[model samples]
Target: ITVSNIHIKSDLAIGEEVMDSLAPFIVLKGQDINTLEGLSLRQLEEGIFFMVSPNLKKFSRLRSLDLQDCNIYLQEGKTRSRTIGRAIMVRTLSCFENLVRLDLSFNYLLGCLGEILDALKLPLEFLSLRNCDLNEDDLECLANSKHALSLQELNLSKICQFSIYDNDRISSNNLFKIVFCFKNVKLLNLAQNHFQDSSIPSFCEKLPQNLKKLQYLDIAGNVLTEDSTLQICKALAKVKTFQWFRLTCSNNLLDEALGHLNQAHENAVQAKQRICGLLSALGRTDIHIEIVKLSYAIFVDLMDVMEL
Candidate 1:
């Protein structure tokens, strides 16, 4: 059957036998099933198992699959299941070789990142696993994935369980390795994680020139400092393909470093005007309008003072 502009949102449950009878001979041809637009399946009650069916492979034209805020049990009873179970679930989905986008964010899935990476050696272009209880080992597995070379966008934001604390003892080298793995990534998001200023220099040093194809980079809500921001700016300047960027250092100490970015002609015009407007509204008339001429310098000064 052919349907157009349809939206499906339900909480019904069906067993395997029922699913077999109701399975679509051909899934619809709208954005979720056919077009390049991404899918969103958030806060699902039955978890991803609801979407899984013996006949799922029939949808040969499927492209994107999004399963955000899904629930996956890490243990059964008092004992934990072997990693194989998790691997099987992911592998089942990866069988869809045509799938280009996959998002499994906020799933509380624990362990077996290796299995997930192994299954992902397909032609996926976008992947997101934000706040999925991932650790350093998981990050390493993703970085080293053979399929990662084909990935265009990756998001690992708010996965604080991976943070390196004195108790957790995750090494800096492992973190750097993960960052380096995205050398060819076109868009990357690592916001609200544990990255700090100390890790900036190493990260910049190892950043791959192959990232010239990268267009978007989001490093917001981290512990970035002025020095770290400066290092990031310098590193990004070498990338010729970057067109969009977001650095959400709301409460960080990188004002000076971010200010220096105003010197870049690309950022000077709009950024300088925005800052000047804010200052004028605050009745800081003493802050001469001429300060806008030295856009980068003003940026650095404002950053030092945390004014902009």
Candidate 2:
């Protein structure tokens, strides 16, 4: 069975027949592809309806599984009492030993990172568990996974579990678990969380230096301050491989520190120009100009104090 561009409803009996047909490729849009067997299933917006039966090993040939935007529900009336989708149960995932990429993002998943970690058996290169209700244990489990060691991009953003008044229990700077768990991650996104200034320095000091391959870092929508910003800059400067740094404190107080930072940058530039002129006089104008350009770019891109 080589069907393309198909739609499946909640009818389970018909879906079972299609799964047993030994199809090589199956595409289900707005339908649950959970019934299809012996094919590479591509599920688009069908994540909400996915319900893994205990006997999921029938699809032994499934290589690529995409379940984006699935809704996962916790036990009824547990936390938010809403339909949330998380990674399928560990028992169901154990059946797919050939999977390469598993995208379980934009779901209503709760704390089930351990189950997800146990289910990953293949050489997965990309995994997205974004917006899931993750905690310290979840971070630890992922960091310890053998499959995760080879991952190039990992997105674990928006994993908060605190109401406005519950800030005291949730430390804004909960970076220890993350830094230790994803020590080898190349791209990390920690946007829209409860990070604070006091918690920033510890994160900066303990960040994995082995993350030299790290290219992108996003810590936006938190409560970072000038002191925290300086610590971050210092930490970033130590990592020679970092290319893009995005720090978002949109609603925080970062205005007063801007003038001081600007003045420091200007002084550094003036000193560099004097040294570059000396080098140019010694017939090394090309090297001097390249260094100057790099420095200027860093100065321009560093954090600018935003008015409250």
lDDT of 1 at 111: 56
Error of 2 at 293 (Å): 26
User: What is candidate 1's lDDT per residue for 191-240, written digit by digit as tens?
Assistant: 65667677788788756364667777766556545456556655665566
lDDT string for model 2 (114-138, tens) is 5676767885666777556555555
- Once fitted onto the true fold, the runs of candidate 1 whose alpha carbons sit more than 4 angstroms away are 1-39, 47-52, 74-88, 162-173, 208-210, 252-308
The candidate scoring highest on lDDT is 1
Task: Report every candidate's CA lDDT.
Answer: 0.56, 0.51
- For this target, which candidate reaches the highest TM-score against the unseen true structure? 1
- Candidate 2 at residue 265, lDDT? 53
What TM-score number comes out for model 1? Answer: 0.65
